[model samples]
Target chain A: MNHLFFQINPLEGFFFGSGKAMVVAGVAIIILIGLGLWLFRMESRLQRLNDALDQRLNDAQNQPS
Target chain B: MIQRSWKIGGLALLGYVLCMIFFVPLGPGLLEFTSTGSAGHVQDQDRKVTVYALTGFGTHWTESPDQLTVVLRHGTQLASLPLIETLDATHVLVGMDLPYTVPSKSWDVLVTHPVDGTLLLENGVFLQDRFIDEQTKWANPEIAEYPAELPFHFPYQPQILETIRNLMLHVPMWFTMFLLMGISFVASIRQLSTAHDLHQDTKAEASVQIGLLFGALGLVTGSLWARYTWGAWWVDDPQLNGALVTVLVYAGYLVLRATIQNIRLRARLSSVYNLFAFVILIILLMVLPRFSESLHPGKGGNPGFNSYDLDSSLRAVFYPAVLGWMMLGTWMYHVRLKASSIERKLRQLQ
Candidate 1:
């Protein structure tokens, strides 16, 4: 077998496996989630502002004028 | 109200479950194999390959002139495997493909020093998808005409398997998004004919939101698929290009509404524009496929859902997935509409 001068190379198995795809999907998930959270916080802040304005308007209207 | 809420909630729950279902058994082989030429099976005649020596694995020579390196691996551990060919000073040449009928569910192979019986190489696997393969015998001077392309190899790629998961997550999102957009398109038509401002607004807002969602999901899912299948995040496939352009057009619809102050004109224009969009959507997605080519299935490539694309295991989840996602999208539209109108009133008050 030594005199024959043989060569054996292994096969390359997988290229562009799903790992990279998952990473992209993960990023998209994070982005969507962050946007959702920001929308929620914005809604809360707007509600607070609306409430304060209503309170101020009520006070002015109730003033003895 | 409670009943409606329950219905919507139920629908949403179903959609979430559907999206989350990669758990269902996707056919037999947990480690699926696909090959070049003959798929997973090896052919006769072209047998024998040269590769880096596995110092101590069992080597099997097939009658078909194919070389096979059988690594009897069990789970994650690499144990000792029988090696028929003796490893000389020149390094061992194990065949690239071998037939193994595993009666059990596990096995391993390892390299050890025969003298001290010490294990030298325990287990370290590095198998990349190489461009030039054993079939390139013709390219070499000595064996340029060697007709042996043994062991048509496919990998137990987790990503490809995970891509099978896309049958659940990715497809449903687009389906749901499209459903939402279609609803918005219909509403826009009614609003246009009736001149009901509320209906018009609903149509406009819903279309924009759902269209945006579809665009975003399509972009994200597609990028993920490309990363795995095509080895790129984006490609210039005609179908994808059309989809992307359509998405941008819808986005422009939003921007168009925002910039214009004339309420009536914006409403009217956007409605008409949406109708045009629906037309373009059909043309780009369905009609043009007769003339163009696309890698995506529905567009042009292997166009129908058959055994190759949608197997029975896939159908079990896939059909339900569409229904679930559509219901969820409708619920999202309603909830989002309530929120949108409330915000609008608030803005007017301010």
Candidate 2:
């Protein structure tokens, strides 16, 4: 195996073999980050929308419908 | 309603779990059998065949007066077998009978060993297709195309494997964002027709909120994917650019909503402004990147690289991610409504 490396390129082995593992890990990280941010931002938006609506309604009632 | 919610949620969970159970593919796509000796390919009909009755690891052959029977088969097609004689301790001498001829084509030839009364080989010989022409003693040699690619094969078909776990999270962000923006679009439209529909305003507000959720998610997931795949937090790709533009447009929607206070004017102008933004959103995210090529999955003349992106193992988890995120989005929307109603009740009390 050592002698095979001396004759051939190191990227050749990784490009074919363990390179697959790299792609798998790389894509997984991408997906993970997307999901986490989605959850967090959605959560905050839901809260903000409710608060803003309450303030608007309060201001409306104070002026009389 | 609370009890029903629990039951419905339980049933959905059960159904999802059951779908995962049918994941195992069961069929005769693959088969294996053990035999006393290695199976040999059928060269032709006239070739003398031997059967060994095994005593141990090696078979002990006996010469019998009974005529050796041979059955030649090409898949289901049965052909006449050559007559053979049982000679010596092991070998049978087959006599070339009735002009021994067989079409050169890969066939699952079935040859039975007489001694053990067992199938010798299921796939005895694989032959190449070459019709033997009578005019030429040799097979009619057509100029065959030099076998282009040896055979289509997989060289580590590298794609999102467990990366599919990201689907649950990454893909859902877009789903949520799309859902929220869609509602906002509807609310703005409704406000135009129904002069003073506060409900529409409420919906519009809710929609932008959810859109923000999705936009943020898309960015995080995309950035994460960029880091892992491209070894950077960001890159200038068409699809990514379009997604960024869509998020920015939604952010602008929020800014526009906050700046105006006249409910009637806000509803009318915000609605008009939102309509334009969504039109731009569709053009930028849905249209432009598609005309140009994109690193994102679905773009370019290429239908996109998702053939291997989603495997069953990942699909098992991905569907749940979508459901969970969607349910969570609905939950948020519902809470917003509740808060709206509570405020209404409190005002009536006042």
Who wins the lDDT comparison?
A: 2
For each candidate, what TM-score against the reference? 0.54, 0.49
TM per candidate, chain B: 0.59, 0.54
Query: Deviation in angstroms for B18 in model 2?
Result: 17
Highest TM-score: give the candidate number: 1
TM for candidate 2 is 0.49
lDDT of 2 by residue, A1-65 (tens): 12232223344335334445456445544554464455446546756765777787688779875
lDDT of 1 by residue, B154-188 (tens): 21222253356565557667666667667768877
lDDT of 1 by residue, A1-65 (tens): 21221122111112122234345445655654464455445555655665766676677668967
- Superposed model 2: Cα runs more than 4 Å off: A1-65, B2-162, B301-308, B340-350
CA lDDT of B54 in candidate 1?
Answer: 43
Q: What share of the true interface contacts does candidate 2 keep?
A: 0.03
Give the residue spans of candidate 1 off by over 4 A. A1-65, B1-22, B25-159, B298-308, B346-350
Which CAPRI category fits model 1? incorrect
